[model samples]
Target: MSSDQVKNEIRRFLKSDDKLALCLRGKWGVGKTYTWDALLAEAFGNDTVSPQKYAYVSLFGLETLSDVRKSVFEHTVGAASFRETKDLEATFSSISERVAQLASKWRAGIGIIRGVPVVADYGGLVEAGFLDVRDQIVCFDDLERMSDGLDLKDVLGLISFLKEKKRCKVVLLLNSDALKEQDADDFRVQLEKVIDINLEYDPTSAEAIEIAIPNRSTLRSRLVAEYATTLGITNLRTVFKSLRICERLEEVLKGYDERVISQAFHSACLFAFALYQPNDAPPLETILKNRPYSDLFGNKEEKTPEQIQHAELLRRYRFLKVDGLDLVVFNSIRTGVYADELIKREADLIAAQLDLNDKDAAFTKAWDIYHDSFDDNGEEFAQALKQSIAENAVAISPSNLSASIATLKQLGHGEGTNDIIAAYIGSRGEGKEFWVGDPILPRFNVEDPDVKAAFASKAAEFADNRTLEEVATSIVRQSGWDNSDLDYLDQKTAEDFYKAIKEAKGEQLRLLVYGLTYFRNVGNPDPRMSSITTKAIEALQRLGRESEINRLRVSKFGVEVPAA
Candidate 1:
């Protein structure tokens, strides 16, 4: 049974005033030790059980045999001399003398002891008369680790003896992985036949706490957005081996559980996307644990600098929405952020802080709030961003640079100047300030993204439920051009693409037609493709023009983990 069920069985058996024994078996790293530690703590604190009456032990490491005998003698007699610890007394005369001494103790014990020796610490406790024989609980751990391998006869004797006790509970705990699969089966079979109750580990609650739940509903989305943003700059791509990276991060940042550990593993895969972001990359030298906080307006709690940066990235991306407020990100490469909503929210906050008039007062104080100590190297780090904008891109919005930068850094992916600028700007959005320079970037001949959109729509249709030929035929029909002028498109390739569009029949032919159409609608997508050529017609034939290329490159090398 599962851990919870085992705990339940233990609870039920306890009501009978029986000595309870529970066996917990599982692989070592699967959380056996961790679960038991938690269960023991919770069990003893339960109102129904008296803590002093129960104890736990590992059979393999109890103590010297000599110490065991001494303890047994003391407990049984209420007090026993060190000299009387063993009937053998180091130098026994013979077996006859030992038997006689043992009989003498039974006689002396009969009058002094009120109850039979039914309860014991271990199997050896039977000889010491410590077994209460009626009501008690004994938990044994690591019994498999005992020096002398346990024999079948000995196990049978122990089970039969416990059954005879009738009112005792026996608990056994094992790390399943430590044993061979063969021996494990036999042990489990034996345990299941005798155990009255069983339990398994419950780490979900603990794992939840480690990730800081309850507060998560408010912050998890924002956190994920920021994480995703970082992945962009770092060029995170979908790859299988990334599992280990994420797993370790989760263990370091949160805690471990089967579910949480699994997520940590996947997170590493997901972060590959963030790792390859084109702009605002994570600090190259420092670990995420040491990264600085980027959020100027955030909780001043004991959070790492990276966390603050994460929060700021969320705000810039609009991944986080302020309740009861309309937010907008405006750019001004010269000045800084401009938020219509924040201006209103903070306008009042500033007026209230300064105790200004209610009329034009809010705006009057808002101006001071906007420019308040806005300098380089301040806690907000406002000046650093402002400087970058002043030097390169414009700070188009006073709203939330963090969110804008985050979005641009994630989406504005390219190579060289155009790519760096695109990634930087795309983090914010495809807004007007982010227009491509004519020389470095070419404009799509088609005003509408319809050509590319049509390809995706049909591709989805085919993927869901359609034959390849049907999809090919459908695409060919849609991609056929009705006009001949072709406008400013690359002359030679455009004519040939139009000719190919006329002759195509199957999937490959359809793909070429689609590629040409997409080029007509969207600029060259692959950064690597630029080195190949920019000819509108011929670029369609370029290899590896997939939009996923930028992300894949970034992921492989993590040059960009967007921080904005």
Candidate 2:
């Protein structure tokens, strides 16, 4: 039933004096207990319910019938006292008075003296305490989590007794799907005898979000609610977690544009759901490693079930893109440690890029040829595209640049592609740092051969201009090398390698030595790697002859060096 329908039923159950048990059932973490408690609080405050007393007990660790009896007595409170105050001492005093009255009555009936002990043992106290449970409203929750020693038949028998023998109103809260197969069968057989009304408490996604985040006046809360509903997240626990993550992100992203905050909130919602509800969302490793578009269109081999599900989720939600800021959000959720400065730094960069995009409105509109309409405006689009490239080539990302070049070629404006490429390359400042290790070329997707040749030529110029020390320093700082670094190493002579090694000392020397010889330690070195290894060892051997410490350090590589 919907939340409103279930709540109306609960209100009716509260007003009637019928001696029957009601069962509220749902999946785990769907707010079964939360809903029941909120309704009870409302009923007590409004003075519209029939019951004068209330008792709520969770059967989580209760092992015996005696434990259940004691807990119900302890948790019971009068209606006025529930609305007036939540003082545990006052509630316990009321229960103590009732127990003393019951003990005195038993003593008088047995003709025992006033000073004599009426209760002989703890079992006597337990029985007398349970006598106060009659004619009051009681709720039993977490029935599936009760100890294995407590049999289902016995618990059901207790509920039946509360209704038929004691004349009390009883409510049971449980997650039936969480029970084991045999126990579930046994529960079904026994439940029919005791329960009069069984309400399935399955709230919709929006309804669940309303319960989880009631105060959605803030921008962060509204965005979280919006995306969570779009993703169809019905688990109230997951929604609560997502809200908490977004709250932290809001604090970290203070003083930023609303658009930046919205983007971060989107990432926070997806990452929080993925962490808490792995079955419904993709795995964190998959999300962190794969680009959404690549996952959708780049697979040539057969797709796995997980990949298919991920693609469908992305397509359904229209979350077909991600960026560096998303990675910051994912790490914050996974590690529970938000690097506030780093987050603000990323947000500031995004804010600047967004402002730039806003200023280049015509540049954005130029792409409308593909999206806005299809009225055969090829000539018009070509002129607009060429003008936009000329005006905003510096601001265009590599992927968008590739798309623009490809689009211009399609419109028979092939000659303009070179000018666009030149403008883009010229805007990149005069340094080799732009063409450093591992540029993401796959995302470029440029099909034009001339454009490809331009990028390759620029890369070669940068690589050739780089000195050996610059290459070694880059490798040492990152603690890893790429193919370009290996090619640079391949071009150097042994004397060049030795001179570079001879000029270095201390930690830099150690790191450079390790960087050069890393492949040798891993074994099955490539031929280029083996040649580099040979040259590096020869350099180290020459250096080792200068000092005993150097010889000792070189000996660790399984090479003995003679002292000078």
Candidate 3:
């Protein structure tokens, strides 16, 4: 039922003198209890509802009927008093008055000592207090989570007793889907005897968002609701969690532009759902990969149901990829701890880039030629793209620059692809190392061979500039080396290797020799390994033969120091 329909049903139940029990059932975390409580608060404020006393007890860990009965007595309260002060003090006073009244009625069961009644058992008094719990609206929640020791049949019997015997209005809230098979069967058998009305509390995405984020006037809440609706997230708990994350983002990004806030909010909504509702949303790893549209073409593999759903969700949200700011939002959601300074740092960078993009409206429009229309503006867009690349190529990220290059090449603008690559490379000074750890080209999907060759040339140039000391330090720092690092080492001659070892002393010399010996000990896995290890072994032998102290130091390593 819709939330409004459920509310009306509940209002009718409260207004009518129907002592029958109402069962509000739905999936877990769908706000069954939240909706019930909201309706109760409204009912408490209104004078049309008949019941003035209320009790809400969770059967989550209650193991027996007696435990449930004690809980009901403990939680009972007057609606008028609770609405006014929102405290249970009045309930305690009322319970005390009832207990005194019942104690007089049961005085004969107690033995009198020194003219005072001596009550040996308090269970009877508790039962008496519970017996006074009639004519009130009582809600039992989490019936599915009741302990195994508690029988479903017994709980249902108690609900029947509340409705038929005590003359109280009873409401049972549970996730029927969460019941075990046997329990479900048992509940079905017993539900007919106790429950007079059953309402399925499934709210739509908009209804749930209304229940979760009541004040949707704010931009943050509106964005959260928009993305949540797009993602079809109807779980109010997940919506509330997403809203909390957005609130944190808003607090950290208080003075930022709306566009910046909008980006963060959208990312926060997606990542929050991924974090809290993994079954309904994509996994965190998938989100972190930031490749929503990857592998769309050039592949013939069948997509799984989950993949198809995720693709649709990503398409609807227009979530092409995650950027630096999204990573910050993701970390905040995953860790549940916000680094205010880190968030602000990322937000500030995004704000600056947004401002830059705004100033370069032509650059933005150039991309819109591909995304915003199917018109024959190909020539106009191509010219604009090249112009933008010439002007703002330095500001664009490598991946985005490569995408633009690919787009240009697709439009028969292949002649200018090399110039764009050169401009981008020139903007990044030679001092900056384009290649680190590996020589593999970035998977930017740039199809032009010249662009790839340019990148390879840049990587090789960076590798060639590495001094032996820098290379050895890098090897030791990483504890190993890849083929590229070995390839760099392979370029050196035996005499050059000897010079590198000769320049080091003490621990540095030992560590450098040890790092090189790793390749030698590994049986030369790479073809360059043979030359590099042979040259390193020759260099170590040369160092050992130079002096008696060097011979002792090199011998301590247990490496074979061949004679010169």
Candidate 4:
């Protein structure tokens, strides 16, 4: 039945003093309880209205008849009259007074013993407080979750007692799909013997979302609600949770642009839906590919019965497709690409505001001058040369002058670099900055072949003292090259290493290959070595030393050697 028709049936059932029981069955989270409460709210004018007292007791943890009675007593309000009153506390207080009067009257004729009443009726008064269900509406929810010790027959017997004996109107709310197969089979006979009416609740997707998410004024909320309805999300609980996540995203992304916020909304809703419907959730990669939920069923053969059922459920909910949301856009939002760009742009704006007060910006401005100068602009070249001198004018040792000059020479700006260095040294004449034996002197004098040869000799000498492992580690650290950082390496060094190992025979070669193993563990390289370490393997390949590479691949790196 539609939710409205069910509500109308309930209203009719309630308006008449019928001593019959109604069973409302649906899938979990379709808002059976909410619909019933809405009717109650309408009839009573307020949530706290005690008009025609009612008891709402969930059978979830109740294990016995006593537990059921206790729940009813705890939840029941006012008298059987179900009178119109908005004050729940006052109504309950009046019930307590009435029960106390009943207890006093029962004890009036009893004799006293040692100043104590002959009859103590505290439990009786508490029982008389609300145990009589006649003329009141009593609801039992979560019937499927009732403790196993409480048999269905016993529950039905209690329902019969309330209807036939007490003449109370009873409602039983349950998700029939959630019941175990054997229990469901058993319920066929027992439920029929008790309930006077069975109302099947299958709320439409739109009704579900509307009831689930009441705050639909915001654009994000409405978008999520509409998307949920389109996706065939009929579970009101899931819809409520998804809308809440969207609302939180709206607050978190308040200042973000619309595109970014919309992206966030889709991602957040999908994540929430995944949590709520884990079994039906599509694989993340499939979702990212924008494939329909129906695609989740394997095409290796014909669809299985379970797959067909899931497909039908998806069809019913309208969630079978990518509908109204693109996976690529959702992925961008999920991965924060737009947010990263916005952060970078914000950083640039802040740097502009800080101007020269930002040290990082000042250094960047210095590079801008060098960049323009290296591009063949005479005026920029002169300006860069002038700035280089002033930047190193304080007679500072290891100044920025040598680094900028080296960079300029690396860019093929030999004359410009020489001019900048000359002006910097002239400004620091006869000072420590112009030390004749300074380490920075050779690095800056790139135009001199002697200086270059001398530096190369020193580098070769350094490499000779350092083992291949140490060299590999130094290169890895300096270049920040991981195992995955492929396609880049020093060809000359790799070639030299290959030649060195080739000349070494027996144990010497084995020890030489041993150093490459150290790179296998540098900052988490799993089975493969780092890029600098892989350079060693490449060297072996260059010299056709497949045997050695194969041995090292398995013994040290835990990887199989690739086919030559």
Query: For model 2, how does the per-residue alpha-carbon lDDT over 375-433 read when each residue is reduced to its tens digit?
Result: 98888888888888777765666666767788788778777678778877877664543
Clashing pairs in 2: none
Residue-by-residue lDDT tens digits, candidate 4, 1-564:
667898888777767666789998888888888898777757665333222767788899888777887567657764432344453323456555655555555557452322433235545455554555466778899888899889888888988888888768888998978878878887888888999999998888788888877787878877888778766677887777666656655665566556555655655566556556766565454444443443458645576676566555445544434522334334434554434454334434434344424443455566676565546564565455556445634433333544555555555655554444444445543422223233334433343443334333333332223354344444434544322122223332667667666666665566556555446556665444565466676666555435775456444434445556
Give the lDDT of residue 502 in candidate 2.
77
lDDT of 3 at 272: 77
Give lDDT: candidate 3, residue 2. Answer: 65
Model 3: weakest 10-residue lDDT segment is 431-440
Candidate 1's TM-score: 0.32
The candidate scoring highest on TM-score is: 2
Name model 1 segments beyond 4 Å from true: 1-6, 27-47, 50-52, 61-134, 152-160, 200-564
Segments of candidate 3 deviating more than 4 angstroms = 82-91, 108-123, 340-345, 362-564
**Best candidate, lDDT:** 2
* Model 3 quality (TM-score): 0.63
Q: How far is candidate 3 from the true structure (C-alpha RMSD, Å)?
A: 11.5
Ranking by TM-score: 2, 3, 4, 1
